[model samples]
Target: MSSITVATWEQLASAFYQHGWVWLPHFLSPALIAALCDDLQQQQLRSAGVGRQQDHLQNQQIRRDQTAWLDGSSSAQQDYLQLMQQLQQAFNQRFFLGLFDYECHYARYQQGDFYQKHLDAFRGRSNRVLTTVTYLNTPESGGELVLYDEQDQLLQRLPPAAGGLILFESERFPHEVLPATSERLSIAGWFRRNNSLQGMVDPGT
Candidate 1:
């Protein structure tokens, strides 16, 4: 990926703060996108789970995307992580969000798979503060991200275009993935604050 400048980071923060979500279609370099795509194909993906910790379960009616966590085991993954770290710091500096860490995973949606509208975080029950998605491959049709406003009204329908990045406030908006007519690949991630119960940190999924 190309070098991410401080100005670019500021722009991302400003846009996200004002609009509640930001979509950048040319955020990543082509080489990096290709490398991540290749890595996703080699990884073993499992049915995506809903809810958190003990409440987690796979409900196909609500979601059918498969996923594999990005463990920073490869160069491409490490690079991506570095980019997120920069964003995390930028967020803290500009918004005083106190974001502690970021976690992301590869998501694969096969033909006919979809996820119903849902919020990534509750108002105070979770640590996830912001959501991020980067598309690795482009599908000919379908597989759009439908984001909703606070009142559950339509906000935007984002297509899964390669090299595109989507950022949104986790608790403020509800979103869903439409069924794909072909295989769709992307990375879904979250920026988290340290929300611990007793001494244990909240587990994010």
Candidate 2:
């Protein structure tokens, strides 16, 4: 959190309040970014699925990328998680979001890979309150994240760049990853609220 000063938090807060989403360039330190990039390359990734848990299944027509969940098994991962924890605290203090925890996974897209427009969460049906993404490698071309409003109107097309971070309301924006001309790497994460009941903690996927 020391890496992200109070002024930086204020800027993030202001931007998030003004819009449903915000993008911050060079959000991660170069050393951390390099470490994450190396870590991702060593992971065993599987074809990404479309849905969650029981309903989860591969659908290449919808998305063409590979993924591996992060478990804080390495120093780079632990550091990244700590930063996110600080961010969660900041959001809770500023917006009263009641975020309970964070979950993330490394995603890799090779040439021609893409994910079609989709919503990260559904209102009243999901505990995920916010979506976050940090790019690990900047592809020479393609692989932009395109966001759309509730009315299906285009909002922004963001290019993937190392150390860049993006945050948006999970259920409010429909977004997609354009096909990559080269390889692309990134971490996709979510800030989730607890939805446990009857003494059982809700499972996060």
Candidate 3:
């Protein structure tokens, strides 16, 4: 990926502050996106679940995508993680968001697959502060991401575009993935604050 300049960071921070969300086109390099796409194809994926931990269970009515958590096991994964780490730092520095870490997973939405509208985090329930999605492949049609505002008003409808990224406040927006006519590939991630109790660190999903 290319280095993000200070001016670019300022623009991103400003846009996020004003809108609580931002869409960046070609935010990642094509080579990196290609590498990540290749890595995703090689991984073993499973039916995606809703909620977290024990509450997590597959519900086809709500979602029908397959996913695999990224582990930084390959060079491509490592590079992607490093870029996100820098992004986390940038957010913290600009917004004082106190982001402690990030976690992401490769998501594949095949034909007929969709995820119903939902918030990524609930107030006082989850540590996830920010949500991110970076597209790896561009589908000709279908699989658009629809984002809604606090009043449930339509905000934006984003189509898949390789290297494009969308970022938003996790708890403030409700979003969904539309059924795909073709395959849609992307990385879904969250920036979280440390919500550990006593001395134990909170477990990641």
- State the TM-score for model 2: 0.98
The Cα error of candidate 1 at residue 110, in Å, is 1.0
Please give the ranking of all candidate structures by lDDT, highest first, separated by commas: 3, 2, 1
Residue 154, candidate 3: C-alpha displacement in angstroms: 0.4
Per-residue CA lDDT of model 1 for 1-205, tens digit only, reads: 4666866776787788789789888778899999899889889999998987789998998999999999999988998888888888888888899998999999999999999999999997788899999999899998999999999999999999998999999999999999999999999999999977799877656
In candidate 1, which residue pairs clash?
none
CA deviation > 4 Å runs, candidate 3:
none
TM-scores for every candidate against the unseen true structure: 0.95, 0.98, 0.98
lDDT of 2 by residue, 66-176 (tens): 999999999889999999999999999999999999999999999999999999999999999999999998999999999999999999999999999999999999999
Error of 1 at 99 (Å): 0.3
lDDT of model 3 at position 104 = 97
Better of 1 and 3 by TM-score: 3
Candidate lDDT scores, in order, read: 0.90, 0.94, 0.94
Native-structure RMSD, model 1? 1.4
The regions of model 1 sitting more than 4 angstroms off are 197-200
Clashes of each: 0, 0, 0
Residue pairs clashing, model 3: none
